[model samples]
Target: MSRTRIVVVGDVLLDRDVEGTVDRVTPDAPAPVLDVTGVHASPGGAGLAALLAAGDGADVTLVAPIANDPDGRLLTEQVEVAAQVVPLGHAGRTRTKMRVRSGGHTLVRLDDGGPGTPTTVPGDVVAELVDAADVVLVSDYGGGVTRDAELRARLTPVAGRVVWDPHPRGAPPVPGVRLATPNVAEARAALEAHGRHADGCGGPAGPERVAARLRSAWGCAALAVTAGAAGAYLADGGQVRFAPTPGRADGDPCGAGDRFAVSAALALARGAGAAEAVEQAVVDATGWVRAGGTAALHHRPGPGTPRPPGRAGESLEALAARLRARGGRLVATGGCFDLLHAGHVAMLQTARTLGGSLVVLLNSDASVRALKGPDRPVQHAADRARVLRALGCVDEVVVFDGPDPAAALARLRPDVWVKGGDYDTSALPERFVVEGHGGSVVLLPYVPGQSTTAILARSATGPRPDLEVLR
Candidate 1:
């Protein structure tokens, strides 16, 4: 399928996360001393929204101002990976946010640079991009890029779906936008700013009232108020729908709204209705948060180190603690994985897409012997782990010394427990354990004629086997 073309216009900035460890208190001051471990950086604001849309398989174009500075150069390099960036001229330094974190907790955040008056891009250039786009997203982060009345006017008559992510410090969107997404706080503030009294906007009738007020005030076709863990409340054409988030993955919600905006815009470009687009956006945003949210920009601790990033073999307690701290979604599946066939590869790949990280709980040599009988398990536990680690879809490989992964699940408390399609949820023994921790069980489709037992039987009977049959 051809990708949806999305044009994003708004503010762009650079975000940096400095991760370190905190030990003893400083002798000179009362503050704790931090020993820096690693630093990571990514594009933020509208740049993030554009990158997110591009990541979701859209052809995204970002038009925003970047100061001629080191930060601007860095931002350009990062954003260009996922979008075609059109930089506008500005006189001030590029906006940058630096966060200092220790042991998965943010200690302090320092903001550098300030918003400057953005030089207006030519109207013809702006109009040409908008004209060709399937969706147009305005990510106003209280920056002046969207403040130009002429630029806003140029976008007003575009024939594509328009999604507006508003910031209080920035100008309001022009009329005729298809959708407006704002968090609860931003929604309340926006209503008051427009002289609209949303007296019952925060009550049971909150979504309905707020949506009505905002849709009318901004002349938008629909409005969705993101209520964090409560999900998003959407109102369109006088009908209100509540799209509950799949589950909560706690992390810094800095770019969550931006993710929501781009997801919804892409959905609209794909011909989904406003309510359906909002629903999909909620699901995408939930996944984004589970995958470490803004923390993904920083270094994560791996195995065999005090702080290592990505998935490496570690104790269940340690992995669970780190995932919980980062609000990550852990997707776990277990099996003997004796031969590592095509079926196994496909299952692991599908499981990884369901959440942030995929943990492969491999059976120990003894456990595999018990399950597969004495003659099974052509590869050892360490060899199996090594092969699983080689696959990009597999994140962490943990060898469990039991027939079932109940003990490991108890320790890890994964958000999703995955299995093959051959197994039914009702027949699974660990269903209760997974659900008890507010997690769900997923069964992926199993490939036919791709079992180790079948392969072994064929190998024993024939001199050689066809590679196509194995696949």
Candidate 2:
């Protein structure tokens, strides 16, 4: 499938995260001494949202100005790494947020904001980019970027899908925008600005109220209010629907809402209706949050699911504790991975769906040769390992020394163990190994006719393989 082109424009910022461990109070000032382990510079604000969209295989074009400062240099270096991360102008200093993490929570954050108005380079850049995109995503970080009237006017003539994530600055809406995603606080502010704040609770209180006011005042076609834990609500040209959050044993929720926004736009662009779009986005994003911020983990169900923690689960207690410390899930999936194709993608995403961690177990080159033939698994275990780990969804990969993933899962004992297609759930390989240690297994819905064997036969060397044979 051709990637959907995504053009993200808004306040782009750099997030510098410093991770450390605190031992005890220091004699110097009665403050704790932190032994810093490492520091990472990741994109934040609109830049992060756009980076994630690109990671999901979207053709992304980012148009935003970076300030000509040292922090801007940090953002520039990170952006340059993303080959597709287009920087519009470096005329002004880039917005940078410095967050310090100790133990498990963010202890302190220092933010240095740029002048909240666009410079000459950014203003001219947006006008040029808007003309070339297939869909326009106005990610207003509420920084000074979209404050220009000229930039707002340029967005109106956009001939493609227009999605706006209203910056929390209570800015008035421009005309002809199709969808606006606002959080609870921004929703409340927008309503008050329009003189439409009605007091209520739980039932049509915050976001719904704002949507009603905006749809009437500006003639906006659709609205979605993203509530952190309660999920999001959508109102289109006619009906209104609430997309409920999946009930996962909760974990740290970071960068999850942005995942929802990116998925929502992508799903809608792929022909999913509004309600389906919201639900799918919520499910996927919620799954990511529960996996400890990486978006590849899954956990046991929430407070009210009627079932037990099911079959071959991933994390055992020992491993789960370790993953929590590292801030990701322990994911394990097993397959030939020989001549990798669509079936593999589905399985990898499914394993991720189970929790916040991923570890792929590949059949060793020797093992593949045994299972297929002397000429099979043409790639060595090391080469295969690199290929799988390079996938955006995969975190770490190890080649199974034995024939299958049983030995690998036995040692790693990840929070979840996943298998592809329709193997009998009753005889699932990793069930007893994980469940005996109190972990549960989940059976992801399998996609038929997408096996490796099917793909090879369809290549130019042969006739159209009737995959119906697998059925």
TM-scores, each model vs. reference: 0.67, 0.64
Q: After the best TM-score superposition of candidate 2, give how far the Cα of residue 256 lies from its true spot, in angstroms.
A: 2.4
lDDT tens digits, residues 189-289, model 2? 77767787545675556666565666566556677877777788787776667876654325456667666777777777777776787777776666556
Best of the candidates, lDDT: 1
| Poorly placed runs, candidate 2 (over 4 Å) | 26-31, 83-92, 121-125, 201-206, 294-323, 326-411, 414-471
Residue runs of model 1 more than 4 Å from their true location after superposition = 201-205, 298-321, 324-471
**Candidate 2's TM-score:** 0.64
Sum up the clashes in candidate 1: 4
Worst 10 residues of 1 by lDDT: 303-312
Q: After superposition, how far is residue 94 of candidate 1 from its true place, in Å?
A: 0.6
**Per-residue alpha-carbon lDDT of model 1 for 1-471, expressed as tens digits?**
788999999888788888888879889999988899888887889888877777667888998888888889988887886689888776589888888988777899998786645775777888899999999999998878668876788888972378999888887778878898888878888888999877863553475578777878988888898888668988787777899865444545667788789889989989999988998888767655545566664433432112112112235765565655544688899999898888988989999988877788899999989998998688999788868866877666778998899888988889999998677688788888999999999999878878888778888887444566776
Instruction: Write down the worst ten-residue block by lDDT for model 2.
Output: 303-312
Cα-based lDDT at residue 186, candidate 1 = 82
